[model samples]
Target: MTKKGIVLWALLPFFLGGFAQEAYFPPAGGTWEQRNPKESGLDPDALQEAVKFAGEHEYSGPRDLRLAILKGFEREPYHEILGPVKERGGPAGMILKKGYVVASWGDTRRVDMTFSVTKSFLSTVAGLARDKGLLQSTGDRVATYLWDGTFEGEHNGKITWAHLLQQNSDWSGTLWGGHDWADRPPAEGGIDDWKYRPLREPGTVMEYNDVRVNVLAYALTHLWRQPLPTVLKRELMDPIGASTTWRWFGYDHAWTVIDGYRMQSVTGGGHSGGGIFINTEDMARFGLLFLNQGTWDGRQLLSPEWIREATTPSTPNPNYGYMWWLNGGGEREWPGVPETVYYAAGFGGNFIVVAPEEEVVMVLRWLEPSQIGEFVRKVFAALP
Candidate 1:
């Protein structure tokens, strides 16, 4: 054989090994495989230390989520419980290396409210609509498709799908008795100041507001001509082998008529109330799917291009994407972690962190929010 041919053959196994190490999918209904920490290039003792730290730092909040909601956002004017809220479980999480469980704590099967982590799932539904051609472009003005006065005003009419996905729409108006100005209002401003505040141009500023998030949910529901939950189940979750226990909900008065059938518009978070209630295992599965760049068990459930677009940082917030939080090496970046890492974060310390370069997916629930950066740094310290 030629010298070139011999060299190619010598490198073949290295390329094959890379492929083998990159993909692993747990079965739909059976037990997830657990890899020995040492075999997975991790220090088991250090990993346990991380897990212990997570357990010890459980969120110090009322288990009665309703009271927690009220007290947590007491400064916001007129913030009341408008949707379903459930008591959360103690610290429960799973750390996965190449889709295999490396460590887990608490009850991974217990279902609980995931708050704004639901926004990531909601963002996925929008991506599905884009893929299926239900909607055209993220850059398209929402007013063009939703002409029902939701986006009719001059400022709101300029709002695009990209704006809502990035939480920068500055779209005005109320939905389901939740006023746009009442959510996480400015620390210095009074009611009138916020209510009559000049609207920032869409996509220029990132403000975390549930009312505006719910507006995105409302628009996606209309575009899909059905409940967003139904779309998510049929397209993403079911295909991902997720269990039946997960649920998405909206406010009590969020019912709307679609195709002559009444359907409830789901909320994108649990701030006022009602969001995704799911288990840690399912959350891990979701993170795994994104870690694999939108493929599941060799099937492409979401487009890789869409996943790339979703994780790409928006202009306003360097640490934010299309509903996902990024480690953009800015103020929010975990000190020693990679800038490529992104996560889905929610109230009361629910997080699904995806680290692509490390080939890891971690679902951490009910850890104190302040300790997330420290917890992640510990986990990474265990790596080879």
Candidate 2:
């Protein structure tokens, strides 16, 4: 080969790599910079229409979350508020393309309860633990690390980290005043029947039980040797330049003594109350982290492998991955959207959608729950 041909071949990789890294990443704090919609191949008029549709389809529930929680889960026996809850603001959202804000609406800075979106954060905490070698593999039984009676029984003993993350643990017990069977009880069964029903083997089914979710949080707290919130702030939020306004909380009575230090074990959702209370920008930051395959700027905050495992569909639930919801052409998928898209969703219509192929991170708060698919479809329609 000619000398020129060899030189061109060596420079080819560098040129391609430059294009891969050209997307902008916002600074840690202050105002997030904006980019023209045209640059991202998005139609400005269609993007505005998407924002308008979000505003017009506000969540129908009362702004007073206390009442909303009570009414939403009234069918569950012994359901009652046990933690902090605040009135929520109206519709707020932000859309980012290549880490630059292209469109936003409402009060993006308003902090409010994120409900089950907290699960995805909790899942991240677990990922950090594994990355640091706190606990071994996700397939390892929980009883190996947490020998303190939480996983003592036959059904519980078989539970693994992956099972808990996938919401297929079917862990039968009570934690922080929440009974596993009492959470989202079957429509026709009484308490006696529901409580004593057959237990499915761990990892064989997906059940959205807050009690079991809190159990995972409890185990993770023991593994980390500190409160989950503190670990998150030091390791994630602060590094990502998140505001200090966000807070994570647990039930009022959920405290435990660890290594002579008394600390609270946070909950994974705001079922009774208390979870993540964060604004849209922070949520977008998190989504952007995932969209970039766990890298921020150039530093690796989370391993790409961890992010991939967290988004990959689990066996029992095609629409769920380590707590993040996947759009894997399942029943929950948004029609016409790419299956590569995944999101962190919560009650009351809060969602942080990360579309890797589109280089988009969207935060939506308080849109009608049933309209999410249609809302997402509209957002994708704006893309060329």
State the C-alpha lDDT per candidate: 0.92, 0.92
For model 2, how does the per-residue alpha-carbon lDDT over 136-245 read when each residue is reduced to its tens digit?
Answer: 79999999999889999888999999999999999998887789999999889799999899999899989998999999999999999999999999988988889999
Per-residue CA lDDT of candidate 1, range 125-150, in tens? 99999999988899999988887899
Structure candidate 2, residue pairs in collision? none
Q: Looking at candidate 2, what is the lDDT of residue 134? A: 92
Each candidate structure's TM-score, on Cα atoms with residue i matched to residue i, is: 0.96, 0.96
How big is the positional error of residue 184 in model 2, measured in Å on the Cα after superposition?
A: 0.6
